[model samples]
Target: MRIRATVAAVTGALALSALAVPAAQAGEAPTYRESAAAAFAAAHGTSDKAAFSTAAAAEMDITFSNFKIAQAVKVGTTNKVSTTVTYTLTHGADVDIHSEDFATGPYIYRGAFDTPDNMLFGDYAATCTDTSATTATCKGNIDVYPADGELLNAHAGTWKGGALALDYVTGDYADQGGLGTTLVQRYSKLTVNASPEPVVKGKTITVTGKLSRANWETFKYAGYTNQPVKLQFRKKDSSTYTTLKTITSNSTGELKTTVTASVDGYFRWSFAGTTTTPAVNATGDFVDVQ
Candidate 1:
């Protein structure tokens, strides 16, 4: 992914390019890598199975999924370091012994790291969950550093079947004199799942997709309770987005909307809303509802 324009501009100049420079300077500020490693150490736990299972070790892993220097305000004169990171954890079936808690993987941390290895830290928070009976999902939130915990530097890994893979960043940082600032970053994920077939007069269509708080880490946070997931259908020849029916996914993160059209032209349907997470963009397709 392209680095944030602001960050690029700030740090770019240090390389002699015109860009925002990451707080990594010679006078002594934690490097971006150092700061991330410190946060990862505090957010994860160990899995005995991973320590021995070679296969399990390879699949169960966590990494700094996304990092953004949202903003950096001058702390004192010119010493500051602040950023938010989104960490995504992917567990393979071997490691998914607790598939139920798979979605709870991305951990977030917001804080300032100005001194050499001295990162004035905070806690990390996240939410994890498994919505499907067949597919296990879990999600959780976390904060890192002087804000809450001492996880200044540590490692995180879990065992599934057998194997050893790097799960979390491990390292240390001593705070050095530098400018201090706070920043924000936004992320968006849109998951759209549609039924294999259309709903006939005698049939029901169920399209399921989960819009978990984990889906939109970068966007503003919102809550969803039986939020509306609208489905629209328009004739193959139609020109505008027409509403066919409105329905809400049950507590199970499932949605069912029916379309009954006499003609057999392409029937388009879409799901749209943003209550708990940013709404997935509306989708369209042809279905024979005869």
Candidate 2:
């Protein structure tokens, strides 16, 4: 990425001219060469500033271990994902991890480093336990809701975990400095089944399904219980699905609901996922109304 406008200008000038000039005497008036030199200095000065910021951020030693999220986060769903972070701050001596100077919080950030846009998907304040003079363990819950306007929702896939160094902020503004680690985000899966095919018109049809999400610790899919799910239906030839009612999952993440058969249509389930898991929509189950 371009560091600054002055850097770009100096770069172009360097490409056009290869000659080098000595610094002008103190009594001599400034010339075009001095202007070019100033531009070059401005460009390197910006780089030095960035390097200093990075070094300062590095001083706040942060690490993530045993960081676990119960399930995969679904898009558009508000999931409360739990996290555990360990950190240590070294500034000459061991700095207090709990000090107000450090804005130590758990967050999910986008993987791209090309630009400083909406890199943060979810950020949550954490409660830390001091483990040593320079180290601490923090635990907290992050509420992740990736809606249509959210950048994370635009890209449905894995997101990495990290910690934000809010301590670098001054007044209302703060440079975004955080340490990112290798942690993969999980995605949720939902399924639906409609029974009593070829039912008479106006007859009650039973709809059942399950809501399960990926478990990073176990590397398996498990039922997500006590969560709300929506039952939607669409006519056979219709492209849109309308919500019929809301249902909750049982202890096993099993879903059951009943709807009256009106016409040949498809039945499905849609889950607005939580912070930990991404949102999911089940495939439609078609039923022919006799």
TM-score for every candidate vs. truth?
0.32, 0.42
How far residue 273's Cα lies from its native spot in candidate 2, in Å, is 0.8
lDDT string, candidate 2, 60-160, tens digits: 44444545443344332333333444433322244445555444444454443322223332233466776666455666544433221233323335555
> Which parts of model 2 are misplaced by more than 4 Å?
1-176, 179-185
Determine the C-alpha RMSD for candidate 1 after optimal superposition of all C-alphas: 19.3
List clash counts for every candidate, in order: 82, 17
- For candidate 2, report its TM-score: 0.42
Instruction: Write model 1 residue lDDT over 27-145, tens digit each, in one string.
Output: 77443233333322222221112112323323344322222222321111111223342323333344442432222222222222111112222222233334443232322222222
What's the lDDT for all of these models?
Answer: 0.31, 0.53
